[model samples]
Target: MTARPVSQHAAGTLEQALAMLAPPGLLVGCRRIETGDASHILPGESATILSRAAAARDASGAGRWLARRLLRQLGYGDLAIPRGKAGEPLWPAGVVGSIAHDADFAIAVVAPSETMRGVGVDIEPALPLPPELEPLVLNSRDRLEGCDVAIAGKIAFAVKEAAYKASFPLDGEVLGFEDIAVDLPAGTVTLSNGRRVGVGMSISSHIFALAFVPAGVS
Candidate 1:
């Protein structure tokens, strides 16, 4: 059977992008923008781009552009844009979140109501990892021993990316691949700092992870 394609845009009309991007149970609102035309509309907030070597200028710029647009869409009114000590994008007062952009696409997740303390989202195209680098990233001694190193690496990369996003607001620390461990099935993450974050996965042909922590937590 063929797999379903991931929907790039949030559900509902263009006006509802904020509502659709906002995950349930969180006080914030989120929206996904794919076109360059939307760039001018973005309000406050800084943007970070994560693109492949081949990503076009327009596509790469979309990540930061979309972030600004989403902040304005949610009524943040000219964001105060700050960067964490590790260079992670920091939102203005009363707002906390992260943004990630890849070769073909970009995504911005934000909180309007601030109910959610911190949020992160990451996506990786379904592809095999290089053979040489697999062993370095995988935890071979663990139950992952039997799995293909390429697959393990892909999962590890996705989880770490998600963790990086989730960790942005708690501190400005830059987390290396070795800084966090992911238990895919359990949807949990343990950071080197000893902080635990909750994880959510969107599995399709490609894999995406959304990691978050309640505002009340450190």
Candidate 2:
């Protein structure tokens, strides 16, 4: 089924949003707050937000903001946000996860156990690739093959972002587009470090593309 773009503040209600994003059998809940709210409150569960405007710094910044608030609500405590050697965000002990924020939305996923593994989430607003910049992002083979250039560029961007989050916790490696290769048709990514990761992506024609990956396993 084609993924639908969700925007209304009350789109599905907090209960419904949790139900839609959480894995089966996992209890989930969410609360909406004014951007000015001083604090977020949750006991021990993960929470995320899809903000309107002020909450997010930019399209992508919103996602990170939501993720941070969700972490706080989950009872993870204020994140120390240590910089990994590779400049990735690192959470305190007993936590393993990632956050993805975009222009109009933000999301954060957290798991109690390291066993839950590392998680990376990314979202990009849906837009046509700039004709002049397309060639710089895609290789000659892709350009000559008459493939879907726009989709290819988007997938590449998404995969790189996903890989950055997935691999950050392990060694804080800064990954570039050349360091990651994506097989969108197969929903897979191969890193220069010789690790292979699985990806799940949701695409809405006029909205954005969202991708997620669990940490450590790949």
Q: Write the per-residue lDDT of candidate 1 for residues 51-136, one digit (tens) a residue.
A: 22333334334555556666786676655444445656767676666666455555556664356777787666657767776666
TM-score of candidate 2 versus the correct structure, residues matched by position: 0.62
Which residue window of length 10 is worst by lDDT in model 1? 10-19
Q: Per-residue alpha-carbon lDDT of model 2 for 1-218, expressed as tens digits?
A: 12124544532253354345444222222223234322332222122323344444233333334556556755765544433444345566766556554434445555554445555655555565567755555543222123254566765566567656866665567776667766656666677788666555545432222233443454
TM-score of each: 0.68, 0.62
Best by TM-score: 1
How does each model score on lDDT?
0.57, 0.49
Worst 10 residues of 2 by lDDT: 41-50
lDDT of 2: 0.49
